[model samples]
Target: MGNCIICGQDVDGRICQSHEEDVVFDFRGDSPDQLVRNRFYRGVVDGYADFGVFIDLSPNVTGLLHRSEIDGRLESLDWEAGDTVYVQVKSVRENGNVDLTSSIRQSEGEFRGTLIQERTEEKLPEEVEEGNGSERSDEGNGRERGTAESDGGGGAVETGVTTEAETETEEEPEPEPVETVSEPETAAPTAEPESEAESEPEPEAEAGAEPAAETETAAEPEPREATHSEIADLPDRVDELVRIEGEVVSARQTGGPTVFELRDETGVADCAAFVEAGVRAYPEIEIGDIVRLDGEVELRHDEIQVETEALVELEGDEAAEVERRLADAMTDRARPDELTLVAHDERLEAISGNLLDAAESIRRAVLESRPIVVRHGATADGYVAGVALERAILPLVREEHATSDAEYHYVNRRPLEDAVYGMNDATNDVTKMLQDRERHDEKLPLVVLAGTASTVESEDGLEMLGIYGADRIIVDAAPADPEIAAVTDVLVNPESDDALSTGALASSLATTLNSGVGDEIAHLPAVSYWEDTPQSYLDAARDAGFDEEHVTELREAVALEAYYQSYSEKRELIGDLLFGESEEAVAAAGAPEDVAAEESLAGHIATQFREKLDTEVETAQANTEESEAAGVSVAVLDTDSYTHKYDFPPTSLLLDELHRRSDAEVTIGIAMDKLWIRAETDLDLRAVALDAAENAPNAGISAAGLRECRIEFLSGAREEVEIAVIGAVTEQFD
Candidate 1:
């Protein structure tokens, strides 16, 4: 029996049952699942498939492959498709019939190839020997053939004639099997095609596949990096752009933009997103709507602004749910004691209602312990109108204190006097009202006192009654009423009685009264007397008499009635004593009419007294003058007993004459003793007596001879001397 050429197995007695030819075709276009047939190849190793390992098949696809089917060795094989492998078929079926029972397994070891070739006519040496039955038999035949060929040099050709019979046998068809079993006992093994034949050589395709595989590996995206916690925790920067998602606690659509507040559990932030689409888009974003927004943050003075780019509305329930979740998150992270929910709802309400009151409440809550500013307003009448307080002092003031219907401003709890009036008018009003009420023992509440000035002025009997008392007036540094100085006692300290001056008050009152009276009674005679008057008695006589010429003459000769009338009362009595009582007696006697006559007689009497007095005065003046002119000493003494004791000579008369004559220096002294005069000139005795004592009877007097006179003059006087004079004497008689 001969052996099979492909596997070195004996196949001499066996018909060529496994002989078959397969038409090689590229099946690469078909999907991997469709490529296999039969139960053995269903999920088993079929041919070496070139589909990319982990690359082509997703995790889901690769997971379906059986590990045992992939490679024969279970314990050693990795079983992942990524590992390279060789698959082999143990059986094949005819006419599209697949015997699933036919086994398919991977090769356990390395593979080797076998060859099949057509038969040749020349016998091999081994075959020749076996046919001859001896090694020497083939050797003798070969030697005889070689010796004969060498001697004859002739090549031998032999032809066997079985061609017709062989050709007939090859052309005949084989008979069908008598009994055909539907299923075979053992399936014939089928050879697996080489990996290079099974998979088309596609270098460019693999090259292309490699980049795609690489690109996919590269295309796998990574998770984004998280922002720093601290940076994220801060409020948005002044002008940064950002996005925030929250529920709309409140929404307001003005003519310009839709302003709304977004409240996350963390805090409320103001957002103003402009929507030209009207309320259809904006108003729909209600107070409870969940919204996601993109906006820019801006800081203006003391406030923060968020300008919105986009605002997406969400369902109310969803928004509430989100709000609750956010609240929970914030609450979980916040300190328990200090937990505060600064939600949009609360802030919206705060801004809408009494902002000032809200600010006050917030100030009380947040800045309760801090110092506050108190500011108050002053009215035109110097009264307090209003008050405002703040906790912190600002360097610059924004509002001015109003006066006369103006508003008041405050800074840091201090009154801003520069901005407003300095006076507290309200306090003044209150004081006045309280005083008024108190005087009547009235128990009026302060609330009633808080009314306006006009209201208080209209109150019954309260106009005249000021606070304190009528005299108790406010004396401010700045007085509103000009007449206040005239009415009230403006003392430096109004509260103290010692500061009050009654005389000054009376003077003020008199001045006021006089001013009032003077305006009406300015033309009366008594009043005119205090002003300028007529020149003299002659001028008065001219006014009262009949003829100016006669009156002038009469005034020269005697007194006129106008003259008498012109004299004040005290002067008139002296005139009457000098004149007589009747006119007849004077006319009959050829004297002036008694009125004129008495005036004439009185004139004569006065003339007699004056002439006698004048003679003595002239003589004394002459003597004093002569003495002074001659540079001599002169002295005079009064000899009248009563005069000696009681009267002192008038020195002013003598000094007057002496002053006219003497240029020399002089000195005078007075005591109780006799008169002593000394001068640089010699005086005549007559002139000395006449000038020294004009109306006195002169006793002969000399300085050296006056010791007895001095004693007599000194008798009734105090023991002290009475008069003395001293001067430079040109000559002295010793």
Candidate 2:
């Protein structure tokens, strides 16, 4: 017996079974039968052929290194005849032909240890043995002199061994079983040769136990069945067979095997089953089914996974027990301990309860493996709100799912053209979700509205989702209609009349969703405000390492990009602009020069934002007309003629810049069918629109959105609607 040089575990060779693949060997045998399959060897290049290279494993034993196994073109090899190379012995055919494949580790220095492969066994290099446990006993050598016959796969099942193998590894010097390479299931142990079995001495046994020789001749023992276990406990039971009862969260097939994400009361884990390469395993097992999985725990690439042997769906009381356990654990983990706001404000405090509910719903969706869809307006504040939640939710998604692309599959953000969740958007969402549910067995998504869908205009969309029993959460700064409160699962609209940007409200809710990202989203609320920034938010942003100037740049850069591709959610680009940190960006920008170009991308975009807004402001000021109405100074601009219809600065942004430059008591920018109003004094814009509609009954003037105090009117009644709006504005000042 020997201690494994790599892990210091007891073994028959210098390297343990767990790390046998990490070392390369020098083949000392002169026949193909002596060469072990799936073992890497050092060989001398004999010559090159048009189809492959012939490498000599020994003076008389040679193998063909096929071109198909080479990662690149066969002609790319720089090897010369007689040059030494490393290759894996893929197979030794019955016809005495050895098949070889290329090895990634070509140098002896890359391996932990090197051993000489003899006809019967492997031995460590003389120099390695000199320094590492040189003492060896005749009894140990006799005990270790046995063949580890292949189980028709890449694993070795020891034969001609009995007493030591029966004892546990921790107390005895038994050879640890070599794990099979991608085998479907563990095979039954094979008996030794009859000749060898008859030659072995009989063992003294207990009263009723059979003799060792007789036991060898008997049929192989039946495969052991596993007992139920928790998913979280699998890490401690590596290489041991166990059973787990859980609900399947997702089933994904990769190039190699089918991986099912199973969730139990404690946690979630990945269980892989293979029928063939890329073939779906256990097709009857689906997402949301309560099933019992029998598998051996193993670690692949440092992640724990179960190598499935059997999967059967449970029912009746068994299913109910698993479902109840999962629900209780999920509910406990989903609820946050307390809600913490980024900045102190009484308005946010008033809606703290709703914020908690929204956060809990989102967290629960993640634990239950439900996708979340966020809908927000295509504006700066809206994007800020949406991105804040995205940053908070993506980490949770990655932690909960075992797949690499879980973030992409679990969370989605859609930008709204207007600040209303109309029937068109609802229909699109419903159609896609229904298709996903039917085709992929996905659960209904939790729809989240940020800075949109809080008013009566979105009632139809809300009702559509409600009819399908989908979960809904509304987080907006605009006052929600009394009717919307009854429809949504959670409503987080403040009742205060003070200015509350959606970004500020959503940022607070984000912390409640995942407090780990609290520092990352602290500066978002400050970026949402166009002017009159809150002192508390400014302080928080500074504390989070973003100064006022940098925060302003982020806001402007986001606004410019939001307008360009108003419909598309540029998730990664927006995240980079807002946070200036992305592992994907760093990996793509490998070189220093490429990294330098990506640095401060938001600052460059903000510079363009300033130049374009300055040009639009200059143009709008030149075309403005000033007048007085009912002792109130009013300035109005014909936005349709003065501003570029499809340009960097939209009409709403032009109005804001123009209002900043004007000294008028009220600034109004009128387009062909819609108008935006900005006021220095308190004015109920919805009431003003109502008054105008009453004054000009045939004009069809109606309030559209509260964000910009926007009113929609029929293009044909342009003159009448404009006159009535001006009269109504003057009356508000009276």
Candidate 3:
């Protein structure tokens, strides 16, 4: 007996009542397998011709159908590796592999009936055919045979018939008899039909198709995913090669790669053209060179399309002329508008001729407009003009008896006297000649004269001596030796009239000692005293008490004496302290003993004291004389008290009296031993007053005995005082 799976009915050699069009079969062979209706699936064709159709099932693998298996309609389907299709399991082979199909064919009679029914709207073609023909006959025959076989020897049993016609014939012969034989087997109970229905569909197709798809798809790999841009543009993922052209704005070789900045009319990009050989192949390509390259478009940090294969340089100009012009403009713009030329000896020799010519040209240009002021010096016939020139020769000139070397003497003159002499003798001489030439003859054409002041003087003397009376002299203006006021007056115009004055000029020149030559040249010198003293010191002295001539002589002598004395005192002091007899005696006396030793010590000490006293005397005399010359009064107060011994309070009182009595608002008090004096008023008055007081009766203080002094004055009605003690005097007294 056999059971019909579709209807759960007991029968033998007869069909079950339920006959579904598409049914699944579970085939229990050596391996468990399943079979599904062929109509449920559609196959897809891919690149592999052997597998024209693809069946995708659980385990998610692809099943390939042979090209011959695909319906003829799909033979021309040009598919690729990444194609997809639908398929169903037709049957499971004994090998546990799938038999896939897109669709099943109906009998010829069923097909004709289906077409006629669609036209006439009659009952469904499948239903009409089921009634007319031997429906379920195939299934009946399959059940009958299965029953007979199970009953006979329990061998393999087949459920579905091979063909409907064969099943009909077999069923007719033994219908009743087979039914009776299968009734006992079919009568056994089984699980609910719905439960079986829900579970069977999935595994039925998968178990059969999965393995075949796995084998086929595994052999041929899937294509890679396309990039976003590529996906948006193309329907497939494939390697693409392209060519783009742009002008090379900049090119450089780095890390064996030629990086170029390429620019088209629309935009610019950084393109790297790597050449394995070397950059030498493109020798003509440089910065701003244009080039073209070919390579693959690869995605890097930001879709960097590199052309590492080949590159070629295009023809273009270097733009050298444009670059040169830009560089020149920048250089010219960076230069200062004004420059100061410092006149030095070496500089004079270098540009003397050019300076002279410039000065002459300037003089000629300005002569028609203004009268030139003449000063006494070499090249006195010419006048210097304030004008721009290529060069100004500065000739140094010196005085005949000047202790400095002749080479350091006469030179070109500064715009001012103070500036001329303020410079070193060599520089001063050069300045003096320029100033002299500028000041001398109003009609004399300007010419820069370069040399030391001594040279100018020597030349002038020689000229004067040589030609009885030479009226004209030619020389160059030493622009290198710039006078501050001259430079300022000619270049930067200051509002103060004092700027043009001799006093101002001296101050300006003094200010230039530390500043550069150009700054010093801004102001011209006022009094060009090339006689040796700094014009500033002379001017200060004249402003103090001396006349111009006396101040000049005094300043010159002081300056010269200071120079000599500085060296002399250093030598003398060194000798006396270190290598002289006094040092030896002091050392010897330290070890001496007895009366003879004491006498030696006493002699040394006394000699030292006397020497100190003499020095103090000289200093005190100078101070006293200076005070007296400035005017002050001397007074003496004698008392038993030690407080009054060296006090000059009385002198202060006297100064107060003098201030009250005279128009002077300030006074100076001097005190020495038991005498004191007060010089009240201005510098002149104080000097006179101090002289008179020192000579007064019973004062006892002389110019040589003065010990200390204090200056007392009223600054805007406020009382102020400063004291100065004579160190030499204090030492002598001690």
Candidate 4:
């Protein structure tokens, strides 16, 4: 007996029965029968086959880690031959064959302790032969080696056979009870007629599936027409046999069965079919194929699933009718009835038609099981917009997909460093989506650029997505170039003459996507606005139980956090702040402690936000270079020289806060290579950049990001570019 290393409990082996899964063992035994079932063992990757990977527990005993046992595509595995890996022994067959399943603990370091599992009593065939005869039997070894090479089967192909010759001097029939039981079972037939020897390995080869195949054939039910039922109705008819006709949304292989996600006009459900353990059931049926499935309804872990008996791909008129029905149903269900604006505004009212179109595109993507990737600016307003959309779409994703974690699978929100979808961002997104398509048979995602990539600067990135037939949607509060409208599938830009925030627009779009959560998101639009919030939105926020003080705390907290990790979604933390509810409270059915925690967290972050912003603003105000151009107050601060670089509150965000505090008519923050402009009067940044470039040709001036009215110039000509920009600003005021 031994004590368990993890739990300190006494057990028969090094690890206790309850903690057996916690530790990975190194099998020191030579035979497959020595391996304890359901225990994790360290194995070496031998080779790869179409069906699975061959993992050798030792030199003689090998197991099949089938493709279905893999969590992802087989091609995605980085394991090479001879590489050390961990696998669980699911079962062992009578023919010395082993079956393996994927181990949750892949690394040896994850285990609390490691131990050697040795069986000292059982001996190898060669060791037994040595005791009986002084010399080994060459003919017996040759016949076994030849049989091993000739047999093309799934079970244990190599059992380390040795000679079974009874007499020491010459060739003879081997004695029984040679200790190595497998060798005689195989080598005994070799001593019979040549025909019998040839046929002997067939049964050994088919040993893995013999029992299952025989049971399946014998228990085959008589043909009968099953009652047709919709996938939505399967939840009510548990354990009942029924037939369903739908389109295959996705097909995934598990260690035991192939789970196919079938979607009909009503809903989606998982249909599991098993041909054998760790084998693909129906290889011909693929995503988007119309098929008829006969199965028994069963509820597993509160999720309705069908245990498939037979699945057949439909054709001709039957296929056409199902396809047409699905298309019509999706169209009716995906599109929203009307545009529901959180707050009434003339700018938003004018773009109601465009907002509805964009909302419909997002809704359709969810219903079709296509992933929705939202790329938004990494700012308070941008994060609010992204979170608003996430809040609305996640519930729908949960309802539409049969999987519990469908929200993470179907909806993704990626933050952009800048409000522009450049080649780098497009390339990363394209690579991931393409890999997901090839590996998992997922459809191309519908890419939504919120408060970013609506301008002409992102045309290249948009065109790249267009080339792959990925649908694009843009929602921006800024004035967008007219040329970009033609390229995108839907454009929701008001092009309003008044100042507006992207959060205001996107929050309304979120409501249009799912109106059931309208009350929860009513305050989001107000949180996006830093100053000069519309009266209607302010009133709406007040009605949603968020006063001005609480809203300010949320806004400041979101902005402060948004700057630290500008490229990550930070889903849970942001969700807690925006909804003012903790995960614990929600899990406990809306406890009041979460509300107090949310307020406390927001207040703490907001305090830090003020402390950080105040220091930067004080430093920036001290080093300001003030002047007057055509009676308009102008201030230029060398941001690189005055403020902290590569720290919290990035240069762009710092400039925005400073500009808001200043009483000047115009604020210009000039970095070494780029400059940001904010003006009280209507100023066209693109025209100003073009004129400045003409005035100082050597400066290499160009408006790189029109979303922020940001212009780029060569650092060598920083002085020249500054003078030319000031001159352009003077002309605009004059």
Please list the residue runs of candidate 3 whose C-alpha ends up more than 4 Å from where it truly belongs after superposition.
1-507, 510-680, 683-734
lDDT of 2 by residue, 586-629 (tens): 44544344543234676778889999999999988898889988
Q: Sort all candidates by lDDT, best to worst.
A: 2, 4, 3, 1
lDDT of 3: 0.29
Please write out the lDDT profile of model 1 over residues 205-301, one tens digit for every residue. 5544546554444342232221211112225564454556665644433223345656554445556554331122254456556666655465422
**Candidate 4 regions with alpha-carbon error over 4 angstroms:** 1-13, 16-22, 25-225, 276-278, 583-595
Give the runs in model 1 whose Cα sits over 4 Å from its true position: 1-257, 263-268, 274-281, 287-734
Worst 10-residue lDDT window for candidate 3 reads 379-388
Q: 540-567 in candidate 3: lDDT tens per residue?
A: 4344343454333322222222222221
For residues 304-325, could you state the per-residue lDDT of candidate 4 as single tens digits? 7786756888889999999999
Worst 10 residues of 1 by lDDT: 399-408
Error of 3 at 601 (Å): 32
The CA lDDT at 227 in model 4 is 79
Task: Tell me the lDDT of model 3 at 379.
Answer: 13
Q: What's the residue-level lDDT of 282 in candidate 3?
A: 46
TM-score of 4: 0.74
Give candidate 2's total backbone clashes.
0
Runs in model 2 lying further than 4 Å from the true structure? 1-222, 235-238, 251-259, 272-286, 298-305, 582-599
TM values, all candidates? 0.17, 0.69, 0.15, 0.74
